[model samples]
Target: MTAPHPQAARHVRAVAVQPHWSAQDFVTAAAFRRWMRAQLDMARPHLNENGVNLVVLTELNGLPLVMRGGAWALRLRTFERVALALFLARLPRTLPILLRERVSPVRALQLADIDANTDLYLTTCRDLAREYGVYLCCGSAPTPRYERRSARLCRQPGLLTNQTVLLDPNGDLIGVTDKVHLTPDEEAGGVDLTPGALGDLRVFPTPAGDLGVAISLDAFRADVIGTLAAQGCTVLLQPDANGAPWTAKEGLPPDPANLRDQPEAWLESSWQVTAQRQIPYAVNPMVVGNLLDLTFDGQSAITGPAEEAPAPRSYVLTAPRPGFLALAPWVTSGEPPALREAGRHRAALSGHPMENQYREATLHADLTLPPATRPAPPRTPHEDALHALLRGEARAARPGRWPWVLAALPLALLARPLWRRRRA
Candidate 1:
């Protein structure tokens, strides 16, 4: 097996591997480290054997670790009453985890165990990156960044950001990119997070080329991709654990349940940008096993640039089926093979056209089978409303407030017109 290439101004090989994770996989931080190390160890040989210099994993890959100490809270039915009961029962454990602050049960869950797992996740990935000698976009998490007054002082949550931390081959914390948009569903789902500053947007210099990082839906926006291109990012690395459900009633699937069969917004959006701007894009998706009633699917792929080829090819790996690993082999180029092939422009939300289905790609490695489909439970009204707001079909539905506000608005408009006539 070849060692990861020494950093240089040349093409590098990359592999995107999907790990099928579940709440059961992580019952404790120690156990999670072992499991993750084993998984990465197994992948390392394959990546090195294939001469891969860099690796990209999916978003929220660290989430199951967050479930380590909080699995019992998840076992209860996800209704508010049951969740409240669990919250009350777990307060002793929860309070310290929340940095001894009082917050709602859901926020407590986000603040406590998730933060612990994120720390472990970062430390473990950093070790693996150095050990394996591969540059790693070590996956992402809704990580709560912390601020500590001193070494002796307890750390407090500075901000919660859906952030991807990048590690160089030597396991150095080189840079990070935080997601800019949270779909309304993400907001309603209790992820009150801040977006990254666009002014600080950047691309990392790598042996493979300038690597631009974007998380999930950030790739759906034209400006984001344009910014990366303008920043001299020749290759785009997108880490996504899409929560979109496979079969939403209307519109595309919502996150955490984002299925491979569903329309890919990133595909449409990235295609347009790569066509117009000339950047190759790669996507890595997370696969989850029914955690938080959330289902994640994997569809890792590398899309070629647009121009000069008869038909552009997108190297793709079949999504990992439930309880399986989805592995794909990728080789980086300073410019993609189809760099000169022109890609057609299309709206992000729209479905891909048949003519654009250019699937033939270099068979450098074998693709894996996707997991069996898990049927999604019916979405509640709240979930539906959140999704509707995300699709721009409606504003957030505040049940008790909107009705009175709607009624008062019409009366106020009519009264204003009448008062104007009297004054005249």
Candidate 2:
């Protein structure tokens, strides 16, 4: 395996992909690979110019590919419908895992198809990393740890965790980072994923500098950032998938008088965290579009310390302060009035003609990380307050018991008919 050029050690050209999720993309493993290949193909122009050393994708980018085996489910066209289809289709296989693993049916659904989904995700990423000759952060997925020597799944059942893998240009595994903090939905809201160990956090040394990854909510934690910074990490890669509206009010804005939207909240969590740590550079890639009932939207960005001002570019966000090197263009500022009025009515949102144009974007930037001469500014009152609130929330968070009951209700209802047919 050849090493990346020495120049990439300091100045690295990176691409952050804001992918638009669709069921069609995961109709099959080959279809998923084609979709991924198309993303890199779109970045080929930038890759050809100075050669991109790193490509970052968003959190849960591979989660949808669990539908790879369920082409029938993909055709269902709604998350609930697709999920129901998968649950029924894989029920026989999932039940054994569920009973043995003592996991929720949702988790069993994932585990039932784990080998296929994991293989599809890893193989596609490995092939793409080598083909593109770029260090690929293949985004986060809920998967079990595979044995290093045999590269086989441990099949530990409920031990699935949201993990991100880094691959060198030669398609070899560089390192793996599991998300230390899991969202409420991932933990007890039915996904049943385990929280990663903080001690397992480590940086991957690359030609582009030591790269540290914090999957979505993990990036919002100060301790996670501090851990990476203490380890001499230079580039912070935050792969995110925001489950809420981009322009909606975040939970208890730091400044009550001045409410912050999703973007502002994310900026506080991501860019500001890295900037305060003086981590030179940060890349945030977001997943957009909708899958079934969930709609994800965000503007992906590449940022650096606020002190280093570059020439104004059309793609960069300057008004909120000039730390952004490049920001992906989003079609709408907030939820469309129609969408807001319609609420959780999936049919209305999905049927809207403009919905498909939500814009899956690719943001590229050439970042040069120089040694910080000055100390980072002290945490502001807003930062302190927000951090406290976030930490408090994290501590208070527990897997809700309701989701288990709710998930079981559907399984019982769906299985009754099958049982009746067998009795007949």
Candidate 3:
């Protein structure tokens, strides 16, 4: 075989896409795929120079697609009206999950069509990986347990996790990892997602480097980053979606007294974590824009060790810090003063006319991997038992449904549809 491209052995070209969420883009599966393809198209110029080895997307990039058929709600501008439309549209499927899982309507809706959402998310990523001939990290989605026994997705019920999947250029899955840490909103609030077991954490081998993923909040936890670092993971990928204002005080600040804006806080957790762990590289891609009542904002970045100089093409932020290889421009140059005023009035900024201009961005960088570190030690028996205990607790928490008196109205509304279908 001809000698590999000179940069192939030591370096890999990677791109991080900062996608803007749009209900219109997710109106149909085809629209979602087209939107995904458009993201790559934005980086086509860089890909054309030489094939990029990897492309990273932000967390929950496909979650909004859970609204697949509820596009009619877009016409109703108010959050309450839109949510009610979605609940009614998805009632047939969501009601069963609501009663079975004893969850909020919003969470039930997520599980109601999870299989389709997961399929759309995976197939789109797989096809994109093959078409571009690059390793792809499709970000995370709320998915149930699934297996590929005969090259087909065999889904099973019982456990629902926020999962991230990695695929190679051949459209074959390299690995799948779940997010171990759950944010409060994801755990106790309307989302109510199950947390992944720490014992299941793993590193996947790739041409670029041994890849390890820590979705969103997991990246900030020392235990998660430390475990992966010890496992000889040279490159860390963090897929993020901040549901708060970009300039707001961080909810989980590293230092309460010396609080920072969300971007600075994110950098401390991501870039700083990689540096502390001694990982050669870290790529963080953030999802922006608003979905219903929730708004997400952040600057995507590629980071490395301080000693490794960033490429000339890398965009510098306010204070040029070491180890930041590349940074994507913020969706807005600066938060508009009117946004702050709107916040003071308890108004939803997502609905503002100016919010429609949220821009999507893609940042590219060539990362050079360092020599491998020592292998990680196997999990101890105690760790295994702890993982088992957590899983059991999660299962017990979803025990037989409690009575939902409020669901009677929705059930009555659906009675006509059920009668029509049965008569047919």
User: Model 2, stretches more than 4 Å misplaced?
Assistant: 1-9, 48-52, 74-77, 148-153, 252-259, 311-319, 333-351, 370-424
Candidate 2 structure quality by residue, lDDT tens digits, 175-271? 7788998765566554567898897787666776678888887787878988888877788999988765454444531233565555656776567
| Candidate 1 weakest ten by summed lDDT | 415-424
Error of 1 at 156 (Å): 5.9
lDDT, residue 324, model 2 = 74
Write the residue-wise lDDT of candidate 3 on 1-424 in tens digits. 8976554345788788888776688879988999889877766665635644788888877766766877887777544456556777766566667666665565666777776676677778877888888888888888776543322334354467778877788776667778998776566443557799887888876775788999988888888988888788878999988776555556553444665555556765668875574567888988776665566666788887676645433222235567777777654443446434333232234445565355578887787775434443343332232222222321212223334544565455332211000000
Superposed Cα RMSD, model 1: 17.1
Residue lDDT tens for model 1, 1-424: 9897553435456566556555566767777777667656645655645554667776766644535654666565232333344444544544443333444335554554543465567668877887888878877776654432222112234355677877776666656777876654344344445577766567776554577787767776667877887766766777766453222111333454553333234445444445554565443444423343343433455444333222434323222121111223322212322221211111111233521222111111222112212232243332343223223344321111122222222222111110000000
List per-prediction Cα lDDT, in the order shown.
0.49, 0.66, 0.67
* TM-score to true structure, per model: 0.62, 0.78, 0.78
411 Cα displacement, candidate 3 (Å): 6.0
Number of backbone clashes in candidate 3: 0
Residue pairs with colliding backbones in model 3 are none
Residue pairs with backbone overlap in model 2: 79-292
lDDT for predicted candidate 3 compared with the true structure? 0.67
Q: Where is model 3 more than 4 Å wrong at Cα? A: 1-9, 48-52, 78-84, 101-104, 148-154, 253-259, 311-318, 331-353, 370-424
The per-residue C-alpha lDDT of model 3 at residue 71 equals: 81
